[model samples]
Target: MIRRLLPLLLPAFLIAAAPASMADVQLKDARAEAQAKALMETLRCLVCQGQSIADSDADMARDMRSLVRQRIAAGETPEQVRGWLVERYGDYVSYDPPFSGATAALWFTPLLLLVGGIAVARLSFRRRRG
Candidate 1:
């Protein structure tokens, strides 16, 4: 019984352990490929949250990588591709979102929070000392 199951189990194990398929197909031009890769690194992987599309293995990231490569191969500039993605997915998709009225809060919130935190800490320390 064990011998009979061994073959089936072996294939299953191999399949399960196999790495995920490559996300982006290489562009014909090396320069285009490099541009796609750089742009991918700037785009966040929605599924993986912290990883860039270039580094993520999630399905969404894979699709994003393919899209970037396809657009770049079609003669779109990296900025154009990035703009399209930002329009489609919103500013959250890019690691470095452009500053604008819509994104002002995103760019300033951290600085505001740090200042607020420092003020509160200073007050607390003063109160404790007095």
Candidate 2:
């Protein structure tokens, strides 16, 4: 009855609930694997903002790694794969997003902030002396 099937059904339920394995998709060629790894390092993990996809343990990072490997194995250059990802996810997905009109503020905001801080500090010091 139900008791006899419980053990078998338990294993099936566990398997269905388990996350997909990340190792199943990989490039057979060593060079392609290397390319995929390099590309992974350049991609930022959206879920783990501070980590590259290569260094992240997030499920999104794992999927990104799988996509890189599959694309490389299917003969796409690393740049092409990167372009596809950037197009789909926007420049934020890349650690080194291209310099362009849309991203100009992203690239220059740090410099601008630094200069503004220095100017403010200088003005504050002058006021204290006067």
Candidate 3:
């Protein structure tokens, strides 16, 4: 009976020990890790729908994570690295782009559409009422 119990407990023991064994494998430097995490969050996963690189587990997200860590380790500012990625991957890779000339439309287009829709609905309602 004790031998059988040891076999079951051994698996549990190893499972519990796993985290302590791999703690250093994740992130050793808090600040750098935070910077890498922030950069990754700003990037979208090319292969996943509506998933940011930071939250995705896809291969593309893993590659993006590696690139982000490399850029952070090389002393690139988060914004600079993001700019470089945007240049290489276009605005689709960015979860949020800086508001500027061409991107201005992105910021205002939805609001414009909402207002237009409301106006059209009001006009239709008035016509029905008249």
Candidate 4:
């Protein structure tokens, strides 16, 4: 009975002891860590949908985290690093992508929808009152 339970308990213990993900690693310096953390927050994890690279544990997120630190360590400014990533992966990698011809709709669609919705609501209310 004891040996049978030992095997089951060992697996559970190992699983519990294991780190959540390899992305648990961080930069040694406080400033670099903070800077990388901030920059990573601006980036989305392509593999994890809604999660930032800083928060996601997916393999791509891990690589992004590493790259952020590497660029920062190499004396690249935060904006420069962000631009490099965007140039490499396109605006989609950044949570708040820039406005461009290709992404013009993304920039204006929400305001357009809000205006349309208000117009419809106003028409409905006026018709009801009349």
Which portions of model 3 miss their true places by more than 4 Å?
Answer: 1-25
lDDT of 2 by residue, 1-130 (tens): 9999998899998764443464336677989998998899899999999999888988888878877887888899999999999999999999898999999998999999999999999999999999
Local distance difference test, per candidate?
A: 0.87, 0.87, 0.79, 0.85
The candidate that wins on TM-score is 2
Runs off by more than 4 Å, candidate 4:
1-22
Q: What RMSD, rounded to one decimal, does every model reach?
A: 7.2, 4.5, 9.4, 7.7
**What are the per-residue Cα lDDT tens digits for candidate 4 across 26-121?**
768889879889999999999997999888978788877878887787889889999999999889899899888978887899999999999999
Q: Rank the candidates by TM-score, best first.
A: 2, 1, 4, 3
- Measured with C-alpha atoms, the lDDT of residue 94 in candidate 2 is 95
Native-to-model Cα distance after best TM-score fit, residue 97 in candidate 1, in Å: 1.6
Q: Write the per-residue lDDT of candidate 1 for residues 1-130, one digit (tens) a residue.
A: 9999999899887764432343455878999999999999899998888999999988888878878887888899999999999999999999898899999998999999999999999999999999
lDDT of 2 at 42: 91
- TM-score of every model? 0.76, 0.79, 0.68, 0.74
Give the distance in Å from residue 27's predicted Cα in candidate 4 to where it truly belongs: 0.9
Model 4 global lDDT (CA atoms, 0 to 1): 0.85
Superior by TM-score: candidate 1 or candidate 3 = 1
